[model samples]
Target: MSISPIAEPFYADARPIGPDGRRIGVLLSHGFTGCPASMVPWGRHLAGLGYAVAVPRLPGHGTSWQELNKCRWADWYGEIQRAFDKLTANCDQVVVGGLSMGGGLALRLAADRGRDVAGIVLVNPAVHTERKDVLALPVLQHVIPSLPGIANDIKKPGVEEHGYDRTPLKAARSMLAGWKQVRADLPKVTSPLLMFRSAEDHVVDPSSGQIILTSVSSRDLTERILEDSFHVATLDNDAPMIFEESAEFVRRVTGP
Candidate 1:
């Protein structure tokens, strides 16, 4: 039997900066149920531009959604934290970024790391949901192991994200608790922020973006409305724009 796409090698190892001599580090995380494939293009773009970039696949991800249910928020957070530590240990400066649930994780990292984080970038970061079913997750998690998948919310045609097709309920509950903590500590995010909101995102609600802006204390924040893409903007129509702009953001924040 062939390995599932999610189980394939989806992570990108750190690429050393040679020609650019930027010595800037960037850590990019993928969303819930999403594998590193979603962030690979973005990370590769940065690496190609001569920045040391690592796109770490979260624990319990890129394997099976059922396995994801076995993991908690701490497991996921620890994975990214390790990646960030590796980046900052060698590079002169470091920036963190993510998409959707990964965005929340990145924000939490910024809060815990404090001034160590030079900047953050979020593409359609999701925090809270208006769905009443969310309130029932505590009970439903015991009743059901998963829900319909929310992955691959790309606007472009015939594009697949290769994430878990089923959304794990147990993992989602843990992630929700994480988002609560992140929202409470939003004021601690003092790093420069570059946020992109899709004008027509299918996965994350538009209100989620507003919640981030209203909550974060970063005065050096930049927001762009992606009119041509969806929630997975990194792989959508404006993907190149995200890649180039984020590379620029890291360069500008870290100084050449």
Candidate 2:
């Protein structure tokens, strides 16, 4: 069997329209090892509201496991920054949002950009964790080897599961390093934040959500729980909740 699953292709790209007619744009980033495919629905919903949305595939993602392992957090963050800048150029204002690892990057950008970033939305963001699996990255990097697996997690609406058939240790190591950096920098972020946490996320420590709640300087932070979903809550039963809440957040910040 192949060591990595077949590469999944992206269906679209960001398109700019006339500046006078543009709505506020959003840059949506997917979780580690996830493709833009996972965030398509969320992007489509925002676009339906007359907002321009950009979902860029991170480096080494939606391609192959080998490519993913080579990617670091900076690569992912750079991708978001590029997209964010592009969106801002086309629209009057911009919001940044992401799922899982993507959420961490979004927070970092918002924190660093400050007033430049209009708002943020984090879905099951990985903020901080004491989980042994996340900590085992160093040892597993040398001992564990690659295994055949799918790139994305599959969860039905309103269900909970451990997530992914196989976890890539090197990739996990890179992500944890990135999260540590984000944790140290959270205090600087003052943009309004909207965070969604799942009550039954098996992949991340429950306290992960709480860390974000307490750390960020965004006084307008709002927290909600998707009780019926798991880590990938964006795809679970609470997806509509995610859609509604995020849409509302953009509306409140940008004023429709």
Candidate 3:
């Protein structure tokens, strides 16, 4: 009926911090089946650097997989769009980024907003899935509520993403639908782009990143390979790399 009390402890919602003079805003989203816990560190890092930051908890996330099943990709994208609007309301510019499904949502934002979104950064963003099982989701979701989870795919041993343990088929299908929309509009994402892909991501395939790199019309594009992480690289060994480099990337794009 509600979010598990166990997950309550792991839920985090962070907002912008620092001086008003900092005119740059950063909006980040968590992966599918994931809550804000995976991105709190990154959001806090950007906030510490004086950029306004927002990491919103998507609808149906951090609550229950059954609740997530009730949510459509449009619901998730609506939350990101709201957060982005809030960020751009005050800040002179905004940079959007996310992990996994969040990344696809960010891409959608970049495509929709274009010049409004100053830049794009993604870590193991999932735009497409080659899994045959995903093909069965259309029917499986009608019969089964959930399957095995795709959350917390980290290389770090003690770290946890604090996401849903059971993957909701209906919600997964919504994500795939969102991915198709984002991919179709790839040429519309013309902002400067930076992406990091784990060498051994188990959740999103490497081809996901490839499709993005080859499709986006952004004049500036950069790709980095993470040698020491997995799909949830934000919470793993290469987290610092993402934080540091992403901070620099924001500064580079938003300017002094």
**Most lDDT-accurate candidate:** 3
All-Cα superposition RMSD per candidate: 2.4, 4.0, 2.9
State the displacement of the C-alpha of residue 43, model 2, in Å, after optimal TM-score superposition. 0.4
lDDT of 3 at 63: 87
Q: What TM-score would candidate 2 get against the native? A: 0.86
Better of 2 and 3 by lDDT: 3
Residue 93, candidate 3: Cα error in Å is 0.5
C-alpha lDDT (0 to 100) for residue 169 of candidate 2: 66
TM-score of each: 0.93, 0.86, 0.93
lDDT per residue for candidate 2 within 1-256, as digits (tens), equals 1222322322233344345554588888888767776787888888877788888878877656666777777888898898888888777889999888889989989878889899999998886787655465688788874444433343573332222345566877878888888888899999989999888776666677888888888899899988877777777778898998899898788764
Clashes, model 3 = 0
Clashes of each: 0, 2, 0
Per-residue lDDT tens digits of candidate 3, residues 1-256?
A: 5764433322123343435455788898988999888888888788887778888888898888889989999999999999899888878889999999999999999999999999999999999988887899999989989998888788899998889889998888888988998999999999999999999989998889989999999999999999999899999999999999999999899775
lDDT of 1 by residue, 1-256 (tens): 2345543432343444546654778898889998888888888788777677888878888888888899999999998998888888878789999999889999999999988999999999988777778999999999989999998888899999988889999999999998889889998888999999899977888767888898889989999989999888988999988988888898788775
Q: Tell me the whole-model lDDT of each prediction, alpha carbons only.
A: 0.85, 0.76, 0.87
Give the local distance difference test score of model 2. Answer: 0.76
